[model samples]
Target: MKKVCLLLLSVLVFPLVSSAQENTEPIVLLISLDGFRYDYVARFQPENLSRFIATGVAAKSMMPSFPSKTFPNHYTIATGMKPEHHGLVDNSFYDPEKDQTYGIGKKELVQDGTWYGGTPLWVLAEQNNIKAASYFFVGSEADVQGIRPSYYYAYDGGVSNLTRVTEVFKWLELPQAERPRMITLYFSDMDDVGHRYGPNNEEQLSAALERLDRELGALFEGLKSIDMTINVIVVSDHGMADIPVDNFLNLNELTRNIPGRVVNNGALAHVYLENEKDKKKVIKALEKSAMPIHVTDVDHKENYQDLMYKDRIGDILIIPDRGYYLAWGSALPRIRQNAESLGTEVLGEHGFSPAYKDMHAIFYANGPAFKTGLEIETFQNIHVYPLICKILGLPIPEDIDGKLEVLEPILK
Candidate 1:
């Protein structure tokens, strides 16, 4: 009787063990919907995204990092580190040595290899002999640490959301062996529209989100048809906040004598002074500004230490309160392109500090590798990189700021 019981136990355990192994090796696909707010799906538009939320787990909000801009937040999401740790502070940053500003608009201004200092998930995938692909990301084109994803595309301002989605679908359709073990897809419409028109514009925001929803639906349905057990994680870089016209800060009046370049001038402005004396001058002038602008210098070394780097970032930084934006090049009749004018531009924008609820994005995970329907309470863009590594069964780099948790109730 004892021998019979042992054999029966083996019968049950063998299949379970084999199934676990099979499930552990499933594929991972990470999607970052740029400027996507957490509540847009449930509260505002109940379209395809609404359905997705019902099927997958979601957070009330995915809190973004300080300065909550594109480059810093995206790098935080991919590297699971803060802008302070990952080394990406904003879309355009002041390089003290070069005394010039760098932004995505000019590829030459970016020190791709140096800008991104941490190990991205794709790099970890490659280190573990797994394949990875990036459709678009902060440093996808930069030769960071002498490593690049197996497949990627440069950040193109002209590419439509539909076109970008279609390209990712095509890549997903590759043969089983050729398919990337990990893949990333980015959508920037919602953020684009929200910025120009503000999130309060229901009609325009809904329409833009619906378009992205259709693309997501198509991508999901296509993957399902392939019978692939792909783990899909959807996230956003940062949320958008309203920038009122009355809130625009005048830079020239504030920094008349500061010897530095103004890098970020829209919702936020970065000032890089030439020397310690210049930094002090800029700080004093900024504090006395009538618009109520918040000022931080490099010497603070605590809250503002995140802006410190060898030859990057300015000696002083200026962050505006919620309704204000600072601009360089002297304010013209029309400075930055309004996202609401979707006629010629994308639909959303994100660069404000991640303090308001509107600035929170979505974070969701679904796959055999994840705990199903688990709601994580403690999470940020920093945790994403380490989790991606775990999903691919790779080693988590020690340099990253995010730690691997069980993802709560997410895994089965």
Candidate 2:
């Protein structure tokens, strides 16, 4: 009877203990550098980045979740949930419920709240009554769970790296009483230069990295002058890869008369067919094309179970085989006409799988509260939220898919 009673008591006590562990207090500052790669930090010779990694805990790789595009991965990190769980599976996702498709560029569609459908960390923090702030993030402008951050900036493509950094510094400078409990910032230039010139293009990439480094230096300097107790986390969404001119596959040529819309993401394309039969026909045509593209319906999870689900993907998913690429509509013609045109003419692009090392990004943390000079090898972007929760002394959200590792083993 005594043993049984003790076991019953243990069952009753466990949940309360777990809930108690969720709430605590330390500030978290999160930064995401768009298209920033895992190896580029040290390889590009960025002094600021290198210093941060050396002085803080740098991961081997953040290992982005599937559909490895900017918008999905960004939300994935913010929410600490997989694309399947958080529901933003791609940069541009299809909504079957409303029978519509939405991309980041279409602000009107965003206003409808069809594209995003998860409790982003900022909103989660706000709901918990913790003050949160964001520089810019996908779906951040949209009010999720009716919880907007204490402060946030809208996403603007024209915003320069220097401007973004300066704005972040301004917020960090706020007095302790009014300061946000959490903050997020994003920069996109390095990823821009990298996709155009390839990671090996030292000229453009170096300049971009240098510019980012200087901006980072200024940010660090600002933080130094202000209270240094803030815990800063730097990360990236996905990596980049170069597709050769001869390797390009034109979907228009493959599916000349297929009834569907081609949404291309450089090496990847999503063919949204009007009907199931049309999708099958498109798939058959793509398979018989010059360069093989891995085609799949997002609803069929087996083919792309590792990356994302079919419904969240598209009717016909096109993944260029290895060194090849699938181009749609005018983009295919543009790529064929000029190999350099696709990248150099534009800028950078990322929205591939996270399996490749080149597509991985950096994850590092530094703060007075963090364990000093420690390394965390077994971690993912999902782990980010739990660590932030640890810092702020708050209860981790029940809806959050991320596991709390505390990452104390790496701290000095």
Candidate 3:
């Protein structure tokens, strides 16, 4: 009877064990070129990347989620969920429940697992007994859902692009049993330059594109030398918009009558009121402004219904039209006696409504599992997480807003 029971157990487990051994799925490389505008490839003439797009599937552009900030969008791609659904609504938001602020530079808050909702790609990979590594991708360093990628580096901007690629190649060289089949890398030079100088600055933007192209060339050559067949997904969180810094609506001046404050200053101005009854007064003040912007309340944002956590943001949302961004209240009066001392131009900014053309991001993929010469139309950035999960053969969590069917048009 013992022999019979043992035999039965073996029969039940044999297929799973063998399937795991024979799983020769194509290795996946997830990379993000921060603020890589879809037009940058053609605009800057990035030869290597341009050639790469020709050999694989390319999305005309990717529409980011509302607020369109970096942290929110990056987390969106990783979790296959919208920013509100994933609990990262914006780059800078105050969570009244936790009394915690999510900022770009706060390493501790970023590492805090409680702030993140849903399973990031790294954590998902770990759940499937898959080893993964991330170099500087947001949320990779955090312990999400009580698990992290088997091999993830701390998020650090000082790491150069060339070094990042070199490290990936080295990881790929490891023994099959020990190597991480999934990898994520990030490059922030483009975004950095876009923020420092407007996207329209031909000289600086061109230089940033060329530098990225050269680094990508080196990465491709290194992968070839190792003779590894890899599926590479290149994406960007969001694009840059030219904000005429000289012409920003001062929120303080506009909302003087209302007992509220402008909480955030950027493409979107978050307004919080001292009382619920003051909502009407605030809306009236913004409408009175001559600037070309659309102000929405918590009830009527562009995709307000789609957000699972709509209340995370302000009651009064300020979404500026293209070529405009908001300014902080203390910029002129508090800093200097004269408001005239305020700076003139803000080069570039994002976090505007995702509907703008400038906020459109880039998505290009080429590998064994993807069809060549396929160009997909613009889709929501949330849809990208499902594609990564499919390529890695990892289970897509049912709770995510990103659907695997959305990627059918691009799949081989």
Candidate 4:
């Protein structure tokens, strides 16, 4: 009788200890504000963002990976790998192995997990039995590593910012076991306005920033009402630069005779050659005609050694100088017409080398997990993945580029 009673007591005590451990794990909410430049706070001074920065840890600027485009940087933050390693080299890149192209506009391809490499944070969370939810991060819609967040919405730009915030509250209000320990939220307001009116357009850009700031204030207030420890981290994929209409480089006319396919991605272009011998000819033509643009063959192993799918990077890369837009055929004409109709000489663009200050994004964090009023120097965005994993007590994958030590100092 004594032995049986002891066994029953042990079982009950073990479960209670396990329950306490689970409940003590803090919740992390990762928010992305696309196209938010590093200097926007000093330029516009949005109230909520300002307060958040004042109270929590912030980097001077977050350096985006090379070819600082949307899809690549976001995926890099998600998996803690550079764009080349993650296999999403740009917003749109050609996969020679599959004989196909992947672009943000291609819905079927965007949702296909085969194109993405490395484990996204949501996938890591779910694999560890920690519930995760996403309101539309870059990789959230796809089933990465055969796993999707327990709660997620397909990418829908029409959804109101308030509605997304409301959904997050609903997710948090679930029972302890059902509530997600990790959540991702995204906002693209600044990106939209910046692209339309250019980053220097104070009136339109400030208005958008103010509106988003107000919504963030509301989100912060709502979080205070919850009893759990919730850490909020805000990041942006990349920044925007003003590209004048006169700065458009017509690559189509310049490389018309080249024996390869050129995929233009605004600030950068990728050239895939049909014949290996044609590489020299293609590079020569692009360099001669596109004077300001830089043309290089992909043979430089140091620059491409990390690429898991190197063929997707194309045989040659064409990078325009800062503030210059790379366009081909109808794109140039369409952009010209749009600029003419708008009466604006400048349109915003990115995908420049992160060396350009304007290509850097913002990083701010405030919550129980962070040290208040701490400011750090600029750090690469790749380090964020390990920081998030450390906060929630999730196991960090050994292969990620982000090191926990880099961001660990900011944690309380």
* The candidate that achieves the highest TM-score relative to the unseen native structure: 4
Ranking of models by TM-score: 4, 3, 1, 2
lDDT of 3 by residue, 300-405 (tens): 6576777666656777887766776666666734423322243425466788777788888999998778899988899998888888888888888999988889
For each candidate in the order shown, give its overall lDDT on alpha carbons.
0.68, 0.69, 0.77, 0.86
Per residue, candidate 4 scores C-alpha lDDT tens digits across 1-412 of 3343234334433343334333456899999999999999999988888998999999999999988999999999999999888889899989987989999989999899989999999999999999999999998889888899999999999999877887887777677889999999999999998998899999989989988888787777666556678899999999999999898877777677878888755878898899988888777777777347887778875877766778888799888777677787668888988988878899998999889999999999999889999999999999999999999888999988889999999998
Give the per-residue lDDT digits (tens) of candidate 1, residues 1-412.
3343234334433333333323225688888887777778775765556666666767767888877787888888878777877777677776655555668687864536776778777777877787788888877778888888888888776787556655665555565567677887787887777766776678888877766777676656545444456888888877776655545567666666667666666656766655667666567767877776787665676765443353565566777776666755366225444432443222234566666777787897766666545466636778777777766778887877777773533655
TM-score of each: 0.85, 0.84, 0.86, 0.93
Best by lDDT: 4
In order of listing, the candidates' clash counts read 16, 20, 0, 0
Relative to the true structure, candidate 2 reaches a TM of 0.84
Clashing pairs in 4: none
Q: Give me the displacement of residue 278 in model 2, in angstroms.
A: 6.1
Question: To one decimal, what is the Cα RMSD in angstroms of model 1 from the true structure?
Answer: 9.6
lDDT of 1 at 79: 81
Tell me the spans in candidate 2 whose CA falls farther than 4 Å from its real position.
1-25, 111-114, 175-177, 259-264, 277-282, 297-310, 336-349, 406-408
- After superposing candidate 3 on the true structure, give the runs of residues whose Cα lies further than 4 Å from its correct spot: 1-23, 255-262, 290-293, 300-302, 330-346
Better of 2 and 4 by lDDT: 4
Show model 4 residue runs off by greater than 4 Å: 1-23
Better of 1 and 4 by TM-score: 4
